[model samples]
Target: MNLALVFESGDYVLIGVFLVMVLMSVVTWSVVILRIIKLYQAKQGNTAAKQAVMESASLEEAAKKVQGMTAPIGTLTADAIAAYRNYRNTEAKTLAEALPLNEYLVSQIRSSMSRSMRQFDGGMTSLASIGATAPFIGLFGTVWGIYHALINISQSGQMSIAAVAGPIGEALVATAAGLFVAIPAVLAYNFLNRSNKTIKQDLDAFAHDLHVRLLNQKD
Candidate 1:
């Protein structure tokens, strides 16, 4: 009924299921912890970079201030500045270059934001996979364990409640283990997803302000 009994008495397939569940749980927690730390650092860096840019009175001053910043906002600001410069300096006209300065700048800044958000999406796919599949995997282990239990009982001809209950209970442990691995992954995925959206909103607002400043400031 306990884990020790399950491991000792269960066949190789059942044992393999347990080991796989353990590995999935380990991966889930590792990703959750690392992602949280990364997001925290990114938020702090973004806040500092936002303040630095806001305090600057001109585009040139903002550029210089954010030059050394490691935040996603710094990259966004750089992209905005580069887009502005490119639009101004391009004397040769092309179909793609026909867009207004604000539109061009907005496109470049949005691309930078996308790249930054993608970095935070590192382990999300795996978290989703584990959340979706862990329970089914545990059920497979349970079914396999019960099949072997039935086979053993058939050979021995012992149909007692004691014999039937013990193996079935042990088999159900795999399903329980699966749920244990899956629930936290699901919760963490939801939490991290919300956090990423909030960060994206902050970046979007910063990008908008930067665009307005770049348009208004005199060269």
Candidate 2:
């Protein structure tokens, strides 16, 4: 009835389940690391681009200055500036005349921001699904183990600790493996969700700033 002996006698399928759980954990960690790096880079690039845009003399000047830069923030800024320039060139004098144009332009910028957000959020859904399902998968394995153990017990008519220990140990190991896979995956999913929210907030702020600048130009 020693734990070591129980494990040694446990089914190999249970060990395989534990190995799969470990692999899932590794994959989840890898995704988290990659996403963190990407989000950090995008945030830094966006801050720099926003600073450059604010410091520029005019929308056209800002566009020209940031033309070569490629980041979600930079692209949004460029689109806003271009829309404003196009509206001005058409020389629509009244606020009513320009409002529609401004709205259309902002819509374009918003759509671009949304697309970029989706790109940044890649692989997060899969991670979430894995987090939600891994424990259940492990549970399924445990149930299978337990069923087999009970069958062996019934057939052998030996209800002693030695007869029941190995299968029970294997079943419990599946539960442990399930937790090992699920915990970090759930944490990563939450972290990425928060990060996405922050990014969306930054995009919204940028859009509002652009709208304010356009209104000031009309004044």
Candidate 3:
């Protein structure tokens, strides 16, 4: 059937709800796609910063190169470098003197990483909510449609398929609309979750390496 005909044939209220579902689906997918792109870019930037830090001769040079990168890994590296520089400048005689400074820097890096993670995690909650509730919303439309269909049958005292088909078909459309909204949302939610995990892993690894490098510098 043509799109316009299907829509015109359906109960107006159900059609309205279906349109709303379509809007929600579009919004949810848009967020998923945008976030994925941002995360991918962040990942690529992190990789490049890691390589640069590993290859650089001195921590100061590495920090300078990475300072403007702004990705989580680069920011952590910069923080570590700053902490090491501060410790060296102070010319501490023992680990006791250096330990406090390093701890402070690690704290800063951790906070920054956490904030980045939260920012990346945006829109996931909305997607989850939509995935969970859309079916029920559709079911509500279906139930409404069925109720009206039965009311019509009672008033007309007829059992003909022609008399019943329109309302029943309209009701089923709600279920279909709900599934249409929900399926993509659920899929996107899962995919985005896995992507977030991967990003978190990379961030954790970078943080660990930076911690080790900072500790070694103190010795």
Candidate 4:
């Protein structure tokens, strides 16, 4: 409707707030979409990798089976295979030599697991920050709107219903705008965080299984 008239009277404070909300929404949705795609790819790779490991002759074969997989589990599998090849070539013959080599391989798996988890958590902090701050930002706009309305009334020496209600409505709209930005942000943050956690948990178990598989190798 008369967007120009609405923001014109408020010295463009509401317009500024609206723009900020729009930016936040854009950013939040971008992250949400990207993460969903990445996570889905990772989850699919995970299922394939699990089947590969179960069906293959050895852990090395499993890694080879799932070569060039997607992120998260793909990275972990590649690292495990690399570590397996490196240590196996060392030709550690005795129990003592093998024990140390196995420890080294476990360390490699942990490092790889940590890196994957970090990647899974990417963009989460910014999502949380946007959800937390958007409401207060809107409230700031609302507070300023009310203050501006009071100034307008004092200057004009008129406390008419039309004058008072207009500014208050403008300020209240700020609160509404804030909720608009915050709600979806919070919902997305929760959903993604939960899904990431589930993936992380699966990775943790897979790392353990990989550790056992690598150490059990009759190299």
Q: Model 4, 1-219: lDDT tens per residue?
A: 344555676666677887898899899999999999988988988888787777889765777877877667677888888877776666655553366766877788888888877876778887899899999999988888888889889999989999898778867787787889889889999999999889989988888887887777776
TM-score, prediction 2: 0.82
Backbone clashes in model 4, listed as residue pairs: none
Q: For model 2, how does the per-residue alpha-carbon lDDT over 151-217 read when each residue is reduced to its tens digit?
A: 8899989999877876777577777778888888999889988998998899889878887787677
Q: Give the clash total for candidate 2.
A: 0
Lowest summed-lDDT stretch of 10 residues in model 2? 1-10
lDDT of 1 by residue, 170-207 (tens): 99999999999999999999999999999999998888
Against the reference, the lDDT scores of all candidates come to 0.90, 0.78, 0.80, 0.81
RMSD of each: 1.4, 4.1, 3.5, 3.0
Quote each prediction's TM-score. 0.94, 0.82, 0.85, 0.89
Ranking by lDDT: 1, 4, 3, 2
The segments of candidate 1 whose C-alpha lies over 4 angstroms from its true place after superposition are 93-95
Q: What is the lDDT of residue 66 in candidate 2?
A: 74
> What ordering of candidates by TM-score runs from best to worst?
1, 4, 3, 2
Q: Residues 61-86, candidate 3, lDDT per residue (tens digit)?
A: 79888988977788778766776666
Q: List the residue pairs that clash in candidate 1.
A: none
Query: Candidate 4 overall Cα lDDT vs. reference?
Result: 0.81
Overall local distance difference test of candidate 3: 0.80
Provide the lDDT at 189 for model 3. Answer: 90
